[model samples]
Target: MVSVDYLTKPLDIFKEMCRILKPGGLAIMSFSNRCFWTKAISIWTSTGDADHVLIVGSYFHYAGGFEPPEAVDISPNPGLTDPMYIVYSRKLATA
Candidate 1:
């Protein structure tokens, strides 16, 4: 999905993902420095890359029913343009 759609209603989408995922399944959210800025959420457009991780992590946390989210910086170049990251968590077996 596009950044605007996903970032704008992150919690709702996250909850839906959790609902459909089987127990022990993983939900992964990946993003990069690239996006359509005008269509993205204000927080998403305004924050630096590191904060983006926290913002996405917070979505997992607040949505409740998943494992604590973990963040990975899989950026090809740490300081270069288009840095990539993933914030992921698994559905709880009991969820």
Candidate 2:
């Protein structure tokens, strides 16, 4: 959804990711403090790194069939370099 409000919707894409994955599968999405603000989605640019993690977490939550999303700090050097985070969720196992 490349509209005036959002550059892209990760939620839409995450839904597809959930649908494609097998039960008990894992989905990982990475985000960083580095991005072209003008080219990124409004929220991505408007918010800080922490909020970005919650935003990505929401994608997994609303996408359905996934366990709680978790955030991983993978930055090599927090102060020396740009910060990075890996947000992931696992597809729920079939009952």
Candidate 3:
């Protein structure tokens, strides 16, 4: 039941996820892109002009829930919109 805003760092979120997950549990994370026009507009409309604080590549090792990470593509157009990829990762079982 933990909800965080875009202001939260990706590492912090990943750490929180690690804390909550069981030894072999899974976690799904969806993130927006600053390069996306819609997000860019939101940023311009907002005060900070900050669209996204985290990038897509940070999910490699930090996000561990899916043995083979799943990528969910959110971009309407590959060329027009900035692609947003949601990753589902699994935590490794420990001895």
Candidate 4:
């Protein structure tokens, strides 16, 4: 999936990412200020792009097996086009 806005159970997806990744593996998920609004979840459609970053980050944090995720702004031109962002988390390394 290109975006999590369409996910009905995003946290569950992240949990599975953690479960399947080897220690220290990175799991990166990205989103933008764009999506199929009708298909997106209510919260995603209701919130703005900045909030979208936080929402996606929460999926990683609450999923329970990854390091804190980072949200990066990668929009090509601030206002010229749709804004894009990425939230990535690393699976915690096993000792």
User: Which of the numbered candidates is closest to the native, going by highest lDDT?
Assistant: 4
Worst 10 residues of 4 by lDDT: 86-95
State in Å the error of residue 7, model 1.
3.0
Q: Model 3 lDDT vs. the true structure?
A: 0.50
What residue runs in model 2 are displaced by over 4 Å at the alpha carbon?
1-7
Winner on TM-score (1 vs 3): 1
Q: Write the per-residue lDDT of candidate 2 for residues 14-94, one digit (tens) a residue.
A: 888888999989888876777766788877788888898898888889878899999988999988898878888899996
Pairwise lDDT winner, candidates 1 and 3: 1
Error of 3 at 87 (Å): 1.1
User: Each prediction's Cα lDDT score?
Assistant: 0.83, 0.79, 0.50, 0.86
Reference-based TM-score of each model: 0.89, 0.88, 0.47, 0.94
Number of residue pairs clashing in candidate 2, backbone atoms closer than 3 angstroms, sequence gap of 3 or more or interchain: 0
lDDT of 3 by residue, 1-95 (tens): 11222423656667667777787787766554453344333333353212232233244355544255555666678768765556566766750
Clashes of each: 0, 0, 6, 0
Position 63, candidate 2: lDDT: 75
Model 1 agreement with the true structure over 1-95: per-residue lDDT tens digits: 22522366878988998999999999888888788777778888788888988998898899989999999998887776568888899999999
What is the overall TM-score of model 3 with all chains considered together? 0.47
Q: Could you tell me the lDDT of residue 92 within candidate 1?
A: 95
By TM-score, how accurate is candidate 2? 0.88
